[model samples]
Target chain A: MDITDNKENMTEAPVLLSVRGLVKSFDGKTVLDGIDLDVRQGEVVVIVGPSGCGKSTLLRCINALEPIQGGEVLLDGQKIEKDGKNLTAIRQKIGMVFQSYDLFPHLTVLDNITLAPQKVQKRPRREAEEEAISLLKRVGLEGKAGSYPRELSGGQKQRVAIVRALILHPEVMLFDEVTAALDPEMVREVLDVILQLARQGRTMLIVTHEMQFARAIADRVIFLDEGHVLEDLPPERFFTEPGTERAKNFLHMFEFEAVR
Target chain B: MPDLGLNVLLKGKNMQRLLSGLWTAMRISLIAVAISMPLGILLGVLMTKKNPVVRAVLRVYLEFIRIMPQMVLLFLVFFGTTGAFGWNLSGELSSIIVFSLWGTAEMSDLVRGALISIPKHQYESSEALGLSRSQTFAYVIIPQTVRRLIPLSINLITRMIKTTSLVLMIGVVEVLKVAQQIIEANRMASPNAAFGIYLTVFLLYFIVCWPISMLARRLEKKWKD
Candidate 1:
């Protein structure tokens, strides 16, 4: 099978995020090694890997949630370390949707969505609420604005999480297996919202177990094994003709009938 | 002595003094709890930091507070501090200071335990949501900690109130102290008054502590359900 590279370096397609020569280790166990990646505007990049392959750590490093042992991360052409910008400012422009949908138990769904904007951004309450309501509507959770997290279904909670992230109007969204904790029947609803976001040209970095969604939505797919990117190709080639034997083997592990 | 009727007891000056002592004990307890709760929470957060040195220091502090009896702590703060430092402190102030210090350490340890007991995944999930550190603590971590801390803190409050009697040893003149004084005054006139006065002090402590104990239980049930 022929390798397909979907990376397009349009002059207008400025690099919105970049990671170069990234390395990290925990207790002398190297989890990421000499990695480089670039995410352009409006691109959806999906990372797939076997368990313990450092995909999550790589995503965490880009967000600056996990400290990087070496190398640099640039957001929107600005060097994160050299600029001395606070993580909060950088994080404000990056939304994250987690598999567990970590909604605040003390807050109503609307409060969860509006909290950071109202508190951190200092937006007026009415204006924040208005934006939150609209975002809630976008995620099909308008009815859940006043409900506590415990009152919502798992799917509804994840959708609320999406709206919560979107409320910040982030330039990039990171999804870490957002469907992993959902019931099988509820997975499609959350994935549908993600697919819609991708369609609207949101730059997304997804560390996902959902191969089908990755195939359908990713502009570029990266397969990782043993802390290294085994294959960086378009979905067609990534699924059909993975470059390294490690990628092939990693993909095979998910083929267990029970995993479906 | 046997048939001291309710009407007679209510009209007696002794009952009034006993009531005053009860009020004073309640005041001391409330003030101590109010002062200690926030300090406890701050120390609790500090205890959970990633630094082993900090954790070890906090652990030592917690064990020292836990192992030493409260009565001994009171003596150290009240008698020892005053004697050693030559600080002129009032009895009420000294009592509040000692209890607050003791309670703060205990409550802080409880808060630390509750905060650490939460699944690490909760924080990871919050981080995955791109929450700022403060947002992660305020929204995700603190709310959960508050629920767990409430019942335990109330338990501490109840313990504090009941233990305020220990302050009478240092002569703060709370309920138990008042009871001893009244018994002493009436010892020649009424032989059994000592037993009666001691019983009354016991009842006052029970009345003050029982409601708080019940509230803690109820909070546990509500959170569990």
Candidate 2:
């Protein structure tokens, strides 16, 4: 299987997740206005925008974490709704990692990873523990499974958080700035884990500020401004030949920061 | 002048009566706690519900309990209920009923605060992990809420114990009422008995409440981590 061939086929790939005319509002103020997006299986879609542009809210709406005021999110062509009876089933297929690494403070890393599997999936405790250890080892956290979230550094906590989501074997993962809260040095370890997942052909929708990482990993980059998609293109074209002035100015700021 | 009241307190049957009165007070508080704890937790969880009607009703109930004096509540339940409804409410039962009402209101508020204080991310993360609402509460929300509530609830427990002395006003013959009886009996023989008996009552309350407050403080420190 040629890597370039797979990339070429992405345009016609079957959609694993689809967002149609998604709208969200908080206290009568719209945060996400008529947004649309799609993620093909094993494809990486990165969303970039300035602060408060509704980037995070879009990811939350996709997972049904936020109630949408209008439109629908479909996973494998099935509607995701706030009041859906099978929300847990729908959510099981879409794992999310938060920026703060919301690991259960009372639970150890291993327990945190294994909790959903044992409790929701009804997997045996021993089986869940074995799988958790393997996933932990994959992230180079094999020895830290016994540590609490507070005892770990920001990077370690985020890695464990990613592993916690991965153990559920979600078909698509939503990463909401998983590195935003980390120190400069710690961001790499967490990003490396995510990059490794991308290498393993995981379907990921990421909202990130790391322009370089977004450029490196994204098959398609979406530029959002003021709750609307300003541009959606391949990273190469998005960086060099942005179609809109809004996107161009956005990229120009990053370029100026890079030189400084 | 030389602490004659102390002798009256140690006289024939006065000490025994006080001990029994203390027993009555302790028993009433324990029963009230046992009933209120589960009831309060349920109400607290209910208070977090999104339904406006339920919230409004619970809010009214909480405010009513908070604003009404516990002594007045005891009177209403004991004498008023008997007079109005013709129901036979024993003094001890009335004391339990009134305290349970007060305890439930206080406990529910503590629980609500604990539940709300949990960070929003905890719920979101649990939901994203595919845990059902019940699973989220049982495993994620409840554990954190319980840790936060234990110390506060323990403080409420001590408050309930101290407040049980109010039942004496309704003729329950609790420790304070027993002390009053002893003082009245020894008015001619032991002029200073009131001072001695009241001191003993204070010490008895302190003995019961001090350890509990200490325990709450220690727990608050331990769970802070």
Candidate 3:
């Protein structure tokens, strides 16, 4: 199989987010080590690896959700520091959707979406509710606004979570295995929303196990193994002809599973 | 057996003393609840802090209150303070202070449990949404904690009310104290007055606490649903 590299396309676009020599550890165990990458505006970067390979940790570190032992992250050329002044303001520009959805169980769906806008952004209640309603309608959840998180299916909850993050108008979106916890039947709807976002030219960093979905959406695919970025190539090259032996073995396992 | 005691109850000033005593008990408990709830909640949130020194201090205070009997605490505040500190505190004030201390400790534990019970994901999501620490607590953490705390706190309020009966030992003239006074006053005319007066005190306590217990149950059920 012949696969062309899109490295030229990446170099021409303006980078929206960048990571430099990122390192993270927990309880003296290194989870991410010497990671470096760039995500251009309108780029959809997908990260794939086996369990405990630090895919989620990298995303979390980028979002400043996890503390890093070393290195730095920049959003639109501004350094993102964990203890920096205006950290909350910095975080406002990045949105993250977790695997569990993590909707506030005590709140209605509409309230869940509007909370950050009204409270953090200082938007008027009426304005926030109006925007939330429209967002919900766009996601086909208009009638379910009054319902609780428990009242919604996994797909609906995940969609609501996406909407909740989107309402902030984040510069970049991070999806950490958003569909890993969803039922197989429900995964499509959530993924469909993400695809729609991708089509709209939104910058996204996604960690996923769905190889076909990664190929379908990723401009670039990063293969991480044991806290190292083994391969960073365009989707075609990463899939058809992985560079490192580790990448090749990883893809081989996936192909074997597909055949089985 | 009941004829003389019944007469004593209907007699002038006897019923009035009991009612006045009940009023005193109610007032002290309500005041303690009002004062202690907020203080307890603050202490409770502090209890969950990462600072070992602060947590250790709160833990010691909480454990001390839990293990020391309420009656003993009442005496310590009422008599010990008067002797050691020379403050000359009234029985009513002493009761309030003792109960408030106990209530604050209990409330803090409840608040801490409620706060800790909140899943870590909620805080992460709140932070990700750009909410500051205070904003997260106000909008997310506190609301859920309050819901979990209401039933338990209400039950504590009822316990405080009943425990105020100990104030009689300090000469507060609460219901039990009034019952003793009436029994003593009518010892010649009403030999069984003690039984009837004590029964009335028990009935009054039951009437006050039973409704509160029911309300707590109802709240627990409603919030769970």
Candidate 4:
């Protein structure tokens, strides 16, 4: 009922996702160096960092989008590897929404959202369509079922992309800068949809530069720099009294940027 | 009024010869198209593979096909191969083989381009949704690739049909050869027959290729959205 009671219950929820010592590198250049994280059920964790600080890479590694050179990722206690036999099964439980809103251009919005559910999950077509249409309606895209991705605006496409991930009923959702590519005016619309999801108590791991949105939505704000977590604190503390000097300077730059 | 020999198209067995000749040309081209489409798609998918050995092999094959002229390929297959390896090949079979090879090469390259042109996010998002590799190809990659390929592939088909005229040089009795025979046989009777008959042949080729070009343009416009 209250903020403290909700926070306490969220902590009491079982760990739905875990990352232990994740190390990723591209061309022998380390991007995620020995990272450890855990996300509880119905919790929302927002990760914020400077450009190229591995915030996106860390989310990608958890979903097994990028191969982890060292360390392991476990979803619901089952280890997820690059080519693991159960990779798809595990991935089906972790939904991802990208910055560019990569909806299938050839498919209608309804088909785009229902594709994985019908084909991979083997859900019945009518059932998938019903769920997809409901999700579309919830996102304020009620009449967009027959429309293709190209016909939708940037914010509309991003909302459809979110619904496309939601119909599968993923245990954890990963938002990789879902609004970073939008026009400034459209950014609020997409963020509002994400905030609505947050209110529904969806377990999400978000990588974003929207410090204000991050502070507002995050249960715990994580500060990553140079491919390591520097501060993991409540948004109130992380935004106000960051533990490290690097975080303080990062927030200062953001504030200066806001002024400009 | 003096006749320009246009009536030859309806003359005794001449109509039959011309129609059958056109079929001969189309037969070779259509067969080549049928075979090349699937082969090229497979090779195209393979072309995107990161394996160096596969890439090198396909690159060499594509380059070799591109370098040799189609006529030279026909001659090599029909004449040189018979002399060197002692395998007698007919003109129709030779034309089919040459055209198939050329079409396959061009098509695979088109396919590779189409596949690469797809944004990386498409595949990444599909994978993120837990779609298997095959499912991703079937639902996501292949459908979009097919859309991008349609207009280009239709252009390729028209080119192939036009290039079948080259098979007459290799002694294939295709439409061009039929027209030539009719012109020569009736040269004394219809001096104007050359203009009339060749005009008819031009119209025939136009009729076949124009609709295809129109379809391509229509789809390109429709999908441009």
- For every model in order, the TM-score on chain A comes to 0.92, 0.96, 0.94, 0.96
List TM-score per model, in order. 0.83, 0.90, 0.90, 0.93
lDDT at position B41, candidate 4: 89
Interface RMSD of each: 2.9, 0.8, 1.3, 0.9
In terms of TM-score, the best-performing candidate is 4
Q: Rate the local accuracy (lDDT) of all candidates.
A: 0.81, 0.91, 0.91, 0.90
Worst 10 residues of 4 chain A by lDDT: A1-10
Count of backbone collisions in candidate 3: 0
| Pairs of residues clashing in candidate 1 | none
Can you list the residue pairs that collide in candidate 3?
none
Could you give the DockQ of candidate 4? 0.80
Indicate the TM-score of model 3.
Answer: 0.90
Candidate 4 per-residue lDDT, tens place, A190-237, comes to: 988988888788899999989988888889998999999999998989
Worst 10 residues of 1 chain A by lDDT: A1-10
lDDT of 3 at A169: 95
DockQ values of all predictions: 0.38, 0.69, 0.63, 0.80
What is the per-residue lDDT of model 3 for residues B1-225, given as tens digits with 9 covering 90 to 100?
A: 335376677888888888889999999999999999999988998899899999999999999999999999999999999899998999999999999999999999999999999999999999999998899989998888888999999999999999999999988999899889889988988898877888888988998899999999998887772
User: Of models 2 and 4, which has the larger lDDT?
Assistant: 2
Poorly placed runs, candidate 3 (over 4 Å): A1-11, A252-260, B1-7, B82-87, B187-195
